[model samples]
Target: MWPEVKIVHGKPTHSQSQGSVERAHRDIEEMLGAWMDENKTKDWPAGIKFIQFKKNRALHSGIGRSPYEAMFGCPARVGQASAGIPHDLMNHLATEEDIENLLKEMEGESNDLEDPNSHGEREDEENTVPETVDAVRTESNEDVVCGQCYTVLPLGEEVNNDGKCFNCERQGNIVNERKRSRESLEKQATKMLKLSKKKFSEVQVGTTVRVPIPDVDRARGSPRNVLAVVGSVEDGLYKLCMCS
Candidate 1:
């Protein structure tokens, strides 16, 4: 006789998932409160993105890394400048020489920018679809003129085959762009982290630096900002002293 397999549960009311979730909820609440106090805004929904960014970039004690790094296998860019960008990405996107060339090229063009919100606004009156241009996508790489202004699109992916570019098509395209941006940022952060480690070895005993004080609050551009000089180096650690 084949006995029916009985399902055994751990406990009547046992759930370990609540632990992480509760901790995350508490952290998010604290962050949201701080942000609201700082900005004087009650827009919780809008502030969620800002909170998520901080949480993702922040280092986690349990994981010994940031959440972004754990998920992407790369360091997260919290708020660093071009010092954090990797050489590969910098070269791939735009090098310093490329920027110089672009500046030189722009020198000949008019100073008037494409600013729509300027004092003297240049409004586009032709908002309606034109009759001559075909809005729908006909082929894989066919050139389609914009129905609104009759301007030829740079690429075929600019508009969908249904002649609707305002909603899903544009939103999906933006999402793809954002994803690529995140990947680039991750690579940059990882490379910069490595470079920063190497830079620590180059620091001499007399090198002066601005040492960040933990749990200290000060106004912007305050005189109380702490400056320290490296006194000694031991086991890859810098012993710093307050600068006179």
Candidate 2:
């Protein structure tokens, strides 16, 4: 069993106590915002993995190294999975340019009657056509769908019990719309925080400021701000003292 860690609570008035955590949250929010824009989907669970990967790899300004490097005491091997492929095997792999070059070579060789061996190679490739066709047909036959309706049919054993396709069990649901709503909510929250930050006026010691009051906890028509003078400013935050 691991040793129990003590949690130190910071004063609600001073957010500077949890500066690192707040900063990290801001960074993650920015990343999530970008991902939402790029993917245009509410699949945040999928995108979180990519965010974590980037965070671990990215260099920390304070640490002078990435989180992965700091923890492992070594630089992370990026794309090592793909890089592990043998150089000889990689060279043998045909890319688009290689395929294009191959077509050009075949065309040139086709005209050159001098190369009788090239024709034999082309004939050998053509011989595999029947096998490919048979494989496609076999796969298509195995993928049996509901004959009455075009929906995917159940497996052999399941089909006997149900006697109908899965979609036949009617249910109305808007899964895609729900996901879009969630995505919109997350984006709106991020945008609101950004806009609020921008609208915030700079405060210094002796400067009076107005802050919003929660409507749920108090009366809806209650005054938004109680006149409060800034006592001190540290780390770009105002320490406000209420004026009598």
Candidate 3:
């Protein structure tokens, strides 16, 4: 189906020949395991689809862009899948617009509360509660308000010692986790590259080299009997042509 593709077979058990494919397989396995554990399901076939969706949208460290964006030449557009869910069950599924409007409303109420000119206005309206105040009062009876954002959390939901709701706490944790993961990955990659540099030198085109024979082919040839000539080099990868 893909006419533009050129297939080159790699030697069996030679991961260096297909490092990208090996890495992708490792990532997919990790994601699939996490998905299955989160959903409490053993059916990995169903989880693979979700894993693929997430992987394509995730940013690739080497490419510096998501695979979906690289292939489509645009960023992937994601929709709110929880839009049809009931608000009580999925209260945390607030959209960007909803959050923005809530922030604006809170800022306006804060200004109203602080203004000395509004003292007479508040006294005049003492019999009638403001909409924001009424909303807070209504939610406080059934939910807990976050100390940081004043967002109402569902009853029985966990809150941090500092009174931050689950959503706020999760967001903070995710940011910190991502920062630590990125730093660790960068350090590991740098160390690996430094070690590889000391072990291997650059190969030039037309240079004859002895490549290791795969285990499956070892019966027919020596371990390092395969001879090849480097044809070209691009992006630190060498294209080699097998010699008879």
Candidate 4:
């Protein structure tokens, strides 16, 4: 009877239930497409996570609130983020600070980094997770974003150290690029298509899936919900279209 949608970060990631909330479901599907294609993460859950985090903190125009803040009354809190993460890495798990530290330590112990027998190339440890940055509503006003801070960065711009701010060249852990990459994908609907894009993927004639929609599926719905066939692809899409 009642409708409910789940929020990842600060945006409506899925319509978990049904209601009259129909406006932009397809858009979310499109987002997932772009993310999976870019990250090449064949794993369904892994890919959705990639896009979910980005949208939570994106700036919103409607009431000027990201879905994250609206859902939980706050912005998205990124636990930890690594730096220079390669796209297709099977064994690449370098941490955020591994950039110079790893390289320095590796070169210090070995003469040739490109050596065949070399054990260390950059960092000695595996990829370390990024530290959590507080993403919340303003201290006094729980609406506007004062700005996010980096955990690793030293205080002030005078330090001339890592985690510098993009706006004022300050210090920070998560860069603007990473943040933007996530936000851009949120506009589309990637999760929807992958999870329930087609027909007959549900339990019965129109079973609801307990999952989140991706970033690129560009249909219409506030949270995004529709009816479809049980496993018959043709029945699902065609019937689902009528429900929408």
Best by lDDT: 3
Q: Model 4, 3-43: lDDT tens per residue? A: 68654354455465533234334544677788778877766
Candidate lDDT (C-alpha), each: 0.63, 0.64, 0.74, 0.47
Give the distance in Å from residue 125's predicted Cα in candidate 3 to where it truly belongs.
Answer: 35
Residue pairs of candidate 3 with colliding backbone atoms: none
Q: How do the predictions measure up, each by TM-score?
A: 0.30, 0.33, 0.36, 0.25
Q: How far off is residue 131 in model 3, in Å?
A: 26
Which lDDT value does model 1 have at 61?
A: 53
Off by over 4 Å in 2: 1-12, 80-83, 86-244
Of 3 and 4, the candidate ahead on lDDT is: 3
Candidate 3 has its poorest 10 consecutive residues by lDDT at 80-89
Name the candidate, 2 or 3, with the larger TM-score value. 3
Candidate 3, residues 1-244, lDDT tens digits: the string is 9999986554657457598889889988999999999999999999887788898889876555666655555556665432333345346646787655655776898899999999999887875657656776587655678988898775457578999987777667656545555666787789889999889999889999888756665664446567899999989999999845
Between prediction 1 and prediction 3, the one with superior TM-score is 3
lDDT of 2 by residue, 1-244 (tens): 5469765453344355688788899999899879978999888888998898888879765545566655545456664223444344446646766545655775776586567767887687779977986786687676555544656653441332444454442211133333444566677668877897899856657887776664443455668657788899888778888855
Q: Is candidate 2 or candidate 3 better by lDDT?
A: 3
Q: Name the top TM-score candidate.
A: 3
Q: What clash count does candidate 4 reach?
A: 67
